[model samples]
Target chain A: MADIRSKIADIYSLEQLSLKKSWVHDRHPLVKLASTFLFIILVVSFDRYELARLAPFIFYPVILMALSETPWPIVLKRFALTLPFCLFAGISNVIFERKTAFILMGLNISVGVVSLFSIVFRAFLCVTAVLLLIAVTPMSRITAQLRRLHLPDIFVTLFEMLYRYIAVLLGEASTMYTAYMLRSTEFKGLQMRHMGSFAGQLLIRSYDRAERVYNAMKCRGYDSFAARGKKKRLSAADYLYLAATCLPLIALRIIDVRAAYSIVF
Target chain B: MIEIKNISVTYPDGTSAISDISLAIGDGESAALIGANGAGKTTLLLSIVGVLPAERGLISVDGIELGKKSLSEVRRRVGMVFQDPDDQLFMPLIYDDVAFGPRNLGLSEEAVEKRVDAALSSLGIAHLRDRSSLRLSGGEKRIAAIATVLAMEPTMMIFDEPTAFLDPKARRNLINLLRRLPHGKLIATHDLSFAEEVCPRAILLKNGRIFADGRTGELIRDDRLMDECGVEALR
Candidate 1:
C-alpha cells in the first residue's frame, strides 16, 4: 500500500537525522563527523586481514553513537542498504577464491568463508560510519562544512535543496495519501493506473514549493553574502577538546607505518 | 526615484498575469496596490523587485537599471517581505534573521549589530530578538520578518499581503506598526480598510494593470471601481 511505502520513506528520514530534532538538537555535528571520517580512514588503512586490530577501533564509533543517542536500528537499516556492494565485492571475493580448510572452534572452515566474513565485516563498518556521520550531523551542517571545504556551490546547493525538500515532499505525499485514505476503503489508495499521474502531481507540487521557497528566500534578501559566523574564539575549552581528540589521531596517522598485517598472502 | 515603464507579465501558459502595468512612486510616498486574489498584485510587486523579471518592462530602483550589472545594487536598495512570516524568517533566531541582510551587504560586525538592534527596537520586537523565530507568535514572527528587511535599510519596502491571516487586533497592531514606519512602502493587499488606513495613496490593480490610482479614501469610495477590481469597501 502507498501508506506502507510512505511510512518507509518517513522512517528513512526519521533516523538520527529528523529535521525537527536535528535543527535544534545539541550534538556536536562537526566533532562527530570528524570522528566518523577518522574511523573510516583508519579502518581502510588497515590490511583486509587485520580483523583483530580493527576490532579495537570499532569501540570508538560505537560508543560515540550510543552516547550521542542516535537510533541504532535506523542506522543499521541504512547500513543494510549497502549490501549490494558488499555482495558484489565481498561475495566475489568468496565465490572465485581457492578454498583451503582452516580450523575454527575445532571445525574446519573454508578460506572463502574467512575472506567473505572479513569483507562483510569491513563493509558493515564502512556503511555504519557513513550513516552515523549523516545521522549525527544534520545534512545542513555537513553541507555547510562542504562549502567551507570549497566544494562547488552547485553541489552544496543541491545538497541543501535535497535535504530541505525531502521532508517537505514527504509531507506533501502524506497529505495526498491521507486524502486517498479518507476517500476510499481497502488498498483503494494508489490505484495502479493512477499512480503515475499521482506521482507526477506530487513532483509538480514539490517543485512548485521549491520555486516558492526560492522566491521567498530572495524576497527576504537571502543572498549567500549574508552568511554569519560566530567569532567562535577558540576558548581554552574548545582548544582543549580539539587537541585532546585530534593530537592523538594525528600521531596515530604518523605512526601507522607498515599497517603491520597483510591480506595479500 | 523608482520607475516602471510599460511592464507586462504573461505566464508561460499564455495567461496574462499582469498587462501593461505602469506606475511610479516618489521618494517620500507610500503606495498600496489593492486587488482581489489572483489579480496579479504579487506578480506586480515581484516584477518591481526583479524576482520574476518581467518579460517586457524597464524597472529602475533609485534610477539604476535593474539588470545583471546593477542587480546587487538594485536588490540592495529594495527590501521585500513575503506573505508568510515563516518564509521570510528562515534563520534559527530573530537576531540572525534581522542581521541577515546587513551582513550580506558586508557590513562590519558592530555596524550589523547596531542595525539589528535598532531595527528590532523600531518594530518593538526587540525582546523577541534572542528567541527562535519558529517559536514566536504569528504577530511576532511578522514583525521579525519586517525587521529583517528593515535592518537592511532599503530605499523602498514591499509587503505582499501584510494582513493575509491575522486576527483583528493583530491586524490593527500591524497597521499601526506600518503607519509608524518613516520610510516609503508599497503594500499589496485586498483589504480596502487597511489600505485606506495605512496608505495615503492607493493603486487599483486589475488583471495586472493599474486601473486606477488616487488618494486612498477617494479611490476606495468608488464602489464601481471596487467591485470591478474585486475589492470590497469595508467601510
Candidate 2:
C-alpha cells in the first residue's frame, strides 16, 4: 500500500521538475512540443538495422536533461519501466532473421541482433525525448498548445483530465488496498478469491468519484469548452531553440551521417 | 437571497433524498444546515447549485430561478465548495483552478488574473498560486478550494462539510475564515460547535425533512431536538 502511494506520488515528479526555472524550461511550450515530436519521428524513421545512425540522437535527451537540471535517476526510473515492453516487443526479432549482417570482435552478428538493438535504442531515444518534454513543460502549457493547434476541446479536456484522474484512480486503489490489508489478516497480499470484488468496489468508487468531479466542473461552468489562458508569443530564443533542435533532426533524417562519416574518415 | 420552495429531490432508484424542503437564506446571512449522516444535507446543497434537478418545486438565487436557462446565472451567483477539496480543485495548478470560473465566464485574461490574485491573497494562500492542488496540505487545499469559488465573485457561498479532514488548528483557521467572509453562506455540516461559532441561524434536518429552523444558539441548546436528529448537542 505504501509502495502504491509512493508510485502515485512519483507520477507527478516530472511536473515538479517542470516547475524549475531553466533555459530549456523557459522555451515556448509549442517549440518544445514540436521539437520532441520531430525528434521522435526522425528517430523512429530509421531503418531497422540503422543502429549506428540512431546513436547520435541520444544527445537530445541528455543535453536537454542537463540544461533543464532534471535529475537523471527520475528519468531513468521511468525509462526503466518501459524497458521490459520494448525488449519483449523486439525479442522475436532476435530469433528470426538470422542472416549475418556483420562480424563483431569474434563472431558473426545476425541481422536480427542488429534490428533488436535498433528497436531498443529507438525506444530509449523516443521515451527519453517525451520524458524530457514533459519534464520541461507543464501539463497546462502542453494542453494549451494542443488547444491552440485546433485540437477538439473535448479531446484536450480529456487529455488533461485523464492525466489528473490517473492519480485519483491510484489514490482510490491505494486506500482500498490499505483497507483490505487491515481487514484480512494472515494474507501476504490480496487473496485471488477477493480480487474480483476488490476491483468491482474500486470501479464503483472511482465511477462515483468521477461523477462528483464532473458535477464540480459543471458548477464551475465547464461546458465542454476548454478554458483559455494567456497566449504566449514565441520569443527570439524560442525560435532559435526550435531551429537548433529541429533543423538537425530533419537534416539527420534526410542525410545518412553514418555513411558520410565513413567517407570523411 | 437564495430560496427553495417545496423542492423535492429523488435519486434514480426512487430513493427520496429530500422531500418538499422549503427554506430561504437571505443576503449576507450565514446559516448552518445541520444533519446526521444520510440526512439529505448534500442533496439539498446539490439541488441549490442545479447539479441535481428537483423533481418538483423551485430554487432561485438572488431572484433568478434555477432552471435550464438560468443555471449559468444561478451558478455564477452561488459558489459551492464541495465536501472534498479534491473534487473542487481539479486544475493542475492552484492559480489555474482559481482562474477557471472567470475564464469560463469569458473574462479577459488580465481580469481573470486579477480575480485569481485577489482570491488567493484574500485566502492568504498567494504563495501557493503555482503549486499543484495535489501537493497542498489539507488546510491549504481547503482554502485553495474556497478560493476557486471566491474568484467567481459569488454573492452567496455553499460549503459541504468544509472541516471534514482538518486538524484542530486548521479547523479553527477555517472557522475564523468563514466568519470573516462577507458573502451569505449555507454551510452543511454536523459539527454543532462549528455551526454555533460561525452561523447565526441553523436548520436541522431529520431523514430528508426539516425538523427545526431557528437561531443557532437556541437550536444547539435544544437537547431533545439534537437527540431526535441523532446529532450531539453542544454541552
Candidate 3:
C-alpha cells in the first residue's frame, strides 16, 4: 500500500493537491480539465479595471481542487513554482512608462500600470489554470482529451510522445553518465573538446535509440500516432463546467468589459 | 507467414542498410538471421515489421501485401522485440507495458485484462505486474519486453539480439524461456550458440545480404563459411 502511494505521489504533483485518504482517484479528469480551460478564457477576458472581478474566479479552481481531494501542499508548491512567470509579466506593468489618469482614493494613478497588472493577472490565471489542469489530469489523459477536443493533432502528438518516451531516453542518458563516471577517475569540467564529442555522440546514440523505439512500437501493433490508453470520458459535470464558465466569459465579452469600464471611469 | 521479395532499403540519410534480398518464413517455423555489426539485420527486421520502407521489394504478412496502406496491418502481425529492453518498455508499470499491445488492438477492458494476465503469467513475470519496468533488472526487463508484444498474440516474432549482454545463467534462462514459447521466431544474432538453441536454420549475413544459408549445426560447423561471413566460431 505504501509502495503504491509513493508511486502515485511520484507520478503526480500531489504536494500541491495531495490526495486525501478517502479521495476517489477515478473521478472524471474532464471536470478539472473543463474548469481550468474555462477559467483561462474568463480570466483572459477581464476588463482592464475588472482585475478585482477576476479574484473570485481563482476560487473556482481552488474549490474543484479541494473537492477533488488533491493535496494542497503539493498543488500549492506547483503553483508557487509557476508564480514567477506571471510575476515577471506583471512587473511589466511597473515599467509601462505611459502616464494615464486613474483615480484611486481620489488620487490619480497610471492606467498603463493597471493594464500591465491586468496582463500579469491574466498570465497568472493562465498558468494556474494549466497547473491545476495537469495536477488533476495526468498528462496522458490530457493529451488524449486534447485530441478529442479537436486541438491540432500534431502539437498534441508532440507533447504526448515526448512525455511518454523521455523516461526511457533519460534512463539511457543516466546510464551513459554512470559509465562515464565509473571509467574516469577525475572528470572536472564538462566544457572540454572531448566532452563536446561525448555529448554529440550521446545525441547520435539517442537518435538511434529513437529509431529502435519506433521499431519496437511498430512491432507492438501500435499505429496510433496519438497514444494508446483508456481515456477518461467527458462527463455531464464536465459539460456543465464548460457551460457554467464559458457562458459567462462569452456573455461578458459580448457585453464588452472595455465599454463597461469606460462608462464607470 | 512473412515473405520478403526483392527488397531494398536505404536510410533517408543516404546510406543503404539492406539491398535486394528475398526470403520467406512459413507459419510456425523459426529461422535465424545471422549478421555482423552493421550487416543490416536490424534494417531487415524493421522492414518485416514495416518500420523501414523498402526501396524496392514486396513484403507481406499473413498473405497481405505490405505498402503504405497495408503497413499497419503488417505491423499488427509481425512482433519485433528490439535490441534494447529500455526502449521497448515505455509504460511505467509492467502491466501497462504488457497491456499496450492489446489496448492498441482496441480490445475491451475485460479482454485486455485477460490478455495482460495471460502474457505476464506465460512470461513468468506475473509477480512483476505492478513493478516499474524501468527499475527492473536487465533479464526481467527483457522478458517483460517480450511479454509486452506477446499480449498482442502475434504469431510471428522477431528478436534482434535477444541476449546481447547477460550473465551465463540469465542468458541460459532467457534461451530456455524462448524455447518454451510456441510462436515462430526470427532471431538476428552473433551468438551462434543462442541461435543454435533457438533456431536450427541460419542465414549468414554480409554486405547487406545473405552470404550463406544452411542448417545451424552445419553452418556453425563450417569454419570456412563462418570465417568468410565474419561469424566467429563460438569456442
TM-score for predicted model 1 compared with the true structure:
0.72
Error of 3 at B112 (Å): 2.8
Report the lDDT tens digits of candidate 3 across residue range A13-89.
33223222322234455555665666676677667656656655666556656656655665556556756776676
* Candidate 2 residue runs with Cα over 4 Å from true position: A1-3, A152-154, A228-238, A263-265, B90-117, B127-137, B227-230
> What DockQ does candidate 3 score?
0.36
Distance from true location, Cα of A105 in model 2, Å: 2.3
Cα displacement (Å) at residue A19, model 1: 15
Report the number of the highest-lDDT candidate.
2
Query: Could you tell me the TM-score of chain A in candidate 2?
Result: 0.93
lDDT of 2 at A115: 91
Q: What lDDT would candidate 1 get against the real structure?
A: 0.72
Model 2 lDDT at residue A150: 82
Single out the weakest 10-residue window by summed lDDT for candidate 2 chain A.
Answer: A222-231
Model 1 CAPRI quality: acceptable
- Candidate 3 DockQ category? acceptable
* Model 2 local distance difference test score: 0.89
Model 2 docking grade: medium
